[model samples]
Target: MSAVSAVATDRAQADAAVVVAWCDELADITAEPGRITRVYLSPEHARVNAVVGGWMRDAGLRTWQDAAGNLHGRVDGSTADARTLLLGSHLDTVVDAGRYDGIVGVLMAIRTVARLTAAGPLPSAVEVIAFSDEEGTRFGKALLGSSAVAGVWDDGWWDLEDGDGTTLRRAFTDFGLDPESVGTAAADPSTLIGYLEAHIEQGPYLDRAGQALGVVTSIASARRFSVEAVGEARHAGGTPYERRHDALLAAAEAALAVEGICRASQHIGTVGTMTVEPGAVNVVPGLARFSVDLRGEFDEGRDRVWDAITAAFDEIAVRRGVAVEPTEVHRAPAVFCAPALMDALRTGIVSTGEAAPPALFSRAGHDAMSLGLVTDVGMLFLRNPDGISHHPDEFVAEADIALGLDALAVAVRTLTERHGTGPDGVS
Candidate 1:
C-alpha cells in the first residue's frame, strides 16, 4: 500500500483508532461505505466499478473491464483507425483514504469526455481507465493494473500474497477473472496516442504557489528498504550504560539522519515503519527493524542521497555498538513527461487565462509510471492544501476541479490538433 503506503500507515500509526475503524470496515468490504478502503479485486473494487461505469455511459462512452480488472470507457473518433488517447487515474485507495486522490481524476476524466463530445467526436478516440491497483495495498506490488495495460505484467506476480496470504492469482479467480487472461489486458502500443492523468498534487507545492494547476515534469525515482539494527538484549536495571548496545536507539538516530540528509538534498525520504523486540518494559531492546523510502526527481541524485543515508546509519551503528542491515524491497525509475504533452498542458492552462502554470516533479508515484512503458505520459496536478494526501485531510478545491475540467479538455484538443494525422499521435 505504501508507495505513500508508509506515508500514512506507519508515520501516522498513532492514529490507531482511525486505523482500527478502517480495518473493521474493510473486514466487511460491504461495510456501509464509511471511509474509502478499497483494495484490488474485491467486492469494494467491483462496487466502485459499477458505480463509475454508470457515469461512463452517461458521458456517452462504451464501458468494459479488462482482464487485469481495470475499468475502461471509450468513444471513437470520426476518422477510421483513429489513434487512441488515454485519460484517467486509479480508482483504488489506501486504507482510510481521502475522497479525491484518485477518484477526482477519474471523475474529471469522464466529465472532460462529456465536455469534449458535446461539441463532436475528437480527432482521436478517447479512453478513460480507472486503474484497479496503484497502491499495491493487497499484494504489496504497486501498478498491477497499469502494468497490465502497459503490456509489462509479470507472471511471477501471481504468487504475491496479501496479509491473509491470499495469492494474487487466487484473488483473480475469486473475483471471477481468469489469471490466464491477464495478458490480454495489455493495450497495443501502436494504437495508443499517449496517457494523461490529472491528480491531486500530493504535495504542498501547488497550494503554496497559489496555483490551481501545474504540469507535471516527471515522477520521482524511488527506492524502498527494510532496515534492521541488531544488538544483544539484556536486563534494563542491571545493565550499565557503558555495556548497553541498544539497537532501537541506533535505528532512531538513523531515522533522524534520513530526514536530515534528504532535507538538505531537496529530496524526500521516509522512515515509515519501526519495530523493537522484547516488549517488556524492563528489557533492553535488542533488535530494531524499520522501513525507509527514498525518492528524488532524478535517479543519480536519489541514489546519492541513499548512499549518504547508509553512511549515516553505519556511523550511528558503530557509535551505538549495533549492526545495521538494509534490504531493498522496491524501486522505480523516474518517469518524465512527454515534451509535446507537457506543452499541450501548458497551452491548455494558458488557454484558461493563466499567464504561467507551474511545472513540478512529483514525489509520489502514480499509474503513469507503469503506463510510461507503453506510451508517452503526461500529468496535470490540482492543488491540495499543504499537499497532505492519503489521509482524510487531503483536499482539492471544487473550483480547481472545475478549472481542471476545462484545462484537461483543452489539453486533449491541443494534442489532437498537433498530432491528429500521425500514426501514433506523437508530436
Candidate 2:
C-alpha cells in the first residue's frame, strides 16, 4: 500500500480497537439479565452514565448537568465564540436493552474529542451530551431533554404521568433536578450551526445493503389517534347475532380498514399499534378502543393516509350502526435537516474511503428530530447486526463502529472548517 493508503488503514485498525474497548466497558456496566431482562429505568442505566461521565472528566472535558438531568461535557475550541457542534444519544433503553443501542454514538463522540484534544487546537467547540430521556421508558414522553433545548417543552408536558403516577416535573425534582432549570438548556437557534447524532441502524436495511454508515436526511412525522366504538353490552348467547350492535365487530372492521388503507396507499402509510378494552372471554364487548399510528415522510402524504383511515372509520360506523369517535393522541411534524450538513457527512464518509448510503428518515423518533427545529441537524447510523434495536439483542459489529467513528470525525473536521464562527459566534 502507498503511504497514504497505509496511514488510512492504520487509522481504521486503531479506531476498531477503540470501538471494542467501548463495548467492553459497557458490558462491564450492564447486568447478566441485560440479555433478556429489560434495562429500562433500572439502576444499571444510571450506573453506566456515571461511569461514562467519569471517563469524560478524565479526558479533560468540563462536565455539568441541566435541569432536565442531561449531562453535558464541553471540549473547548480555539475560537471563543464558535458555535458548538453538539453530538449525543439517549442513555435509557427498552427492556432487555442491547448494549450498543445508544451508548455507541456517545462514546464515539467522547473518543473523538479525546483524540482531537491530543492533537491540540480545535476550530470550533464540541459538546457531547447524554440526553436525559429519549426511549420514553420512564415518562412515556420521548425527546424530553431535546425538546427543552428546542424551547418546545411546556407546562402540559410537565403534567404527563409516568408508570408510578408521578408527574414528569415531580420526578425531575425527586431526582434532584429542578424543573425551572430546564430553560437553561435552551440553545440559540443560529448559534447551533449543526447537531449530529450517531446511532445504531436498528434495522436490517444497511446490513443487507452491505453499507456501514447511514446519512439521515429527514425525520418522519407521527399522527396517533385513539378510536372508541360503543354499543350496548350483552351476553354472548343472549344477543342475536343479526340484531347485535357489536362494538367489537366495529373495532375489527376499523382495524382491517387501517391495514387496507396502508396497503392501498402504495406504501406511504403504516398502522403499528392497536388495543381493545374490556378483554374478557364471556362478556360481549360493549366498548372497544384502539389506536391508529400513521407515519410519513411528508405532511401531504400523512394527510392523505389520515383521510383514508377516517373515511374507513365513518364507513364502519355506518355499517355497524355504532358510534365511533377518534381522539388524536399526538402529532409531530416531519422535520428535514440542513442540506449542507447532509452533504458534508457524505463527503466525510467518502473521504474515509467508505460508502455513504443515500439519506433516509427514521421510522422511530429520536432526540435529533427535536433539535432540528432549533439548529441545523444531521445523523449517522452505525450498522446493527440484524437491524434490530431498542431490545437486548440490538447490536453492531466492531468494524462497523470504527467505520461510523471515522465518518463522524470527518464530518466534524469538514463542518468546523467550513462553518466555524471563531470568537464572534456563528460567523
Candidate 3:
C-alpha cells in the first residue's frame, strides 16, 4: 500500500480501538458491580462525564458539561459564528446494559471530529453530545437530556421520583446542579444546521441482510398505556367459580388480547410490567395492573392497534364483571429523516465501497425523536449480530465499528459540502 494509504489505515484502526476501549471503560462505571446500570444524575454519570470530557479535550475540542448533565465537545469551523452540526447519542444505559447501544455513537462522533480537524477546519462547526438519560429506567421519563436541548423540557417532571424516593429536582441538587438552570441547556434552533445520530440497529434486519450499516428512514410512533383491572376480593376456596371476580384473570385475558391483535397486524405490542394486589395464598386478587407498549411505522396503524386493545378491554370488563382502565402515559409520533441528510448518508455509505444502503424504520425510540421537534434529523444504524440490545449479550463486530466511523466522517464531509455553512446556504 502507498504510505498515505497505510497512514490512513493505521488511523482508522486507532479510532476503532479508542471507541471500543471507551465503551469498555464506561461499562465499568455502572451502578451495579459486575453489571452495567448507569442512570441520570447518578455518581456514575458524573464520573463518565469526567472521563469522556477528557477524551473530547484530547481530540482537540472544547469540552463542557451542559446544565442538563450532557457532555459536549465542540470543534470550531472556519468562522467562530458558523452554524453547528450536532452529532451524538445518549450515554445512560438500561438495566444490565450492553456496552455499545448509545455510548459508541458519542465516542465515534468525537473520533470523527478528530479526523476532520486533523488538517484544518471545515465549513461549519461540529459538536458532539453525550446525553445524560434516554432509557427512562431511573425515573420513568425518557429523553430528559435531549428534551432539554430541544427546549421542550416539562417542568412537571420535577416531581418525578426514582426507586429511592428521590425526586428529580432533589437528584439535580445532589448532583451539584441547580434545577433552575436546566433551561440554559436549550439551543437556538436557528443556530443548528442539523442533527445526526449513529446507533446500533438493535434488530436483525441489517445482520440478516449481511450488511454492516443501514440508513434510517423514520422512527416508529409509540404509545404506552398503564392498564388496570379492578375486581372484588373474595375467598378462593369458599367462593364458587361463577361467583368470584378475579382481577388477575381479567388482566391475563387483556394481555393475551393485546398480543393477539398486535400479532395479527403489522404493529408490535409488549406487556412489559405487571403487578397484582393483595398477596395471599387463597384469596382472590383485588386489583391488577400491567404496562402496555405499542409501536408501528405509522401513527395511524399504532392508534388502530390501541383502539383494538381498548375494545378488548371493554368486552373483558363487561363479561368478567370487572372494571378495566387504560391510561395513556406516553406518546411519540413517527419522525421522518431529512431528505438532504439521507442523501448525504447515501454518499457516505457509497464512499465506503459498500453496496448502496437499505432504509429501515426504527422500532425503538431515540433521542432523535425529541430533537426532531426542532431540527431536521437523520440516523445511521450499525449492525447488531443477534438483533439484541438493552441486554449484556448485545454485541457489534469491531470491523463494523470501523466502517461506521468512516461512514459517519464521510457523511459529515458531504453535509459540509452540500450545505456550506448552514441549511439556508445549501447549494
lDDT of 2 at 129: 86
Residue-level lDDT of model 2, residues 1-427, one tens digit each, is 1111312345655866776686666766654543532233345656766777887897779987666667788887687777788888877666566767667878888877776677886778888988767777667667777787788887788888877788877777766667777788887776666888888886787777667777887787778788889876777787787777778889888888888887777534444555555667766778888778787878788888888788888988888878888898778888887787787778767766654355667776788888877787888876776787777677777766666677778888788777768433222
Quote each prediction's TM-score.
Answer: 0.91, 0.90, 0.96
Clash count for each candidate, listed in order shown: 3, 9, 0
Best of the candidates, TM-score: 3
* Winner by lDDT: 3
The runs of at least 3 residues in candidate 1 whose Cα sits more than 4 Å from the true structure, single-residue gaps closed, are: 1-33, 424-427
Quantify all predictions' global Cα lDDT against the true fold: 0.84, 0.74, 0.88
Writing each residue's lDDT as its tens digit, candidate 3 over 282-362 gives 999989999999999999999988999899999999999999999999999999989888877876776666756879999
Q: State model 3's lDDT.
A: 0.88
Model 1: per-residue lDDT, tens digit, 1-427?
A: 1011111122113222332343333334432366668899988899888878987898799999999999999999878877888999988888888777777788778877877788898888889999999999889899999999999988899999999999999999999999998889999888888999999999999888778889999999999999999988999999999999998989899999999999999999999999999867998999999999999999999999999999998999889999999999998999999998998888777766677888999989999999998899999998898999999788776556656766787888877655555665574
How large is the C-alpha RMSD of every model relative to the true structure? 7.9, 3.4, 3.1
The lDDT, on a scale of 0 to 1, for candidate 1 is: 0.84
Q: Candidates 1 and 3: which is better by TM-score? A: 3
